[model samples]
Target: MPSVDEIRGRIEAALPGARVTVEDLTGGGDHFRCEIVSDRFRGLSRVERHKLVYAIFGDEIGGPIHALSLKTLAPEEAK
Candidate 1:
């Protein structure tokens, strides 16, 4: 199981200047919900923004990380 810190680190590295908040939805290590706001999301559609966030997870997305409920937005949307 990846630590929350580790996951957050990976996301941060993948998307610079992203503001992320991760929550464990279950007692198990797999389920998580993340709120992500990044400048990279600017001018992107919702699907594109979510895809960007999910890409950071790579294979772990469906394997180790069973679920990731995401709320992705641009910096402007966040404010």
Candidate 2:
């Protein structure tokens, strides 16, 4: 089971200088919601941004991490 902080770390590491927030949606480590803001996402399509984030998790996505709801934004899109 991956902890929220662990997930946040992975995302932050993958997107250097990104602002990431991870929430354990169901009080379970496997279910999560992530909000990511990064300059790397600038000009990328939504699918492309998602794919980038998903790649960091690899096999863990449908396995240990059962569900991940993502809100990805470029720096300018962030509030």
In terms of lDDT, which candidate is strongest? 2
Q: Which stretches in model 2 have alpha-carbon errors above 4 Å?
A: none
lDDT of 2 by residue, 1-79 (tens): 9999999999989899999999999987999999999999999999999999999999999999999999999989997
Number of clashes found in candidate 2: 0
lDDT, candidate 1, 1-79, per-residue tens = 7767777888899998889888888868798888888888888999988888788888988899999899988887886
- Best prediction by TM-score: 2
In model 1, how large is the Cα lDDT of residue 45? 90
TM-score of each: 0.91, 0.98
Each model's backbone clash number: 0, 0
Q: How does model 2 score by TM-score? A: 0.98
State the displacement of the C-alpha of residue 67, model 2, in Å, after optimal TM-score superposition. 0.4
Predicted structure 2: lDDT:
0.95
Q: Local error of candidate 1 at 70, Å?
A: 0.4
In the predicted model 1, the residue pairs found to clash are: none
Among all windows of 10 consecutive residues in model 1, the one with the lowest summed lDDT is 1-10
Q: List ranges where model 1 is wrong by over 4 Å.
A: none
TM-score of 1: 0.91
Task: Give lDDT per model, in order.
Answer: 0.85, 0.95
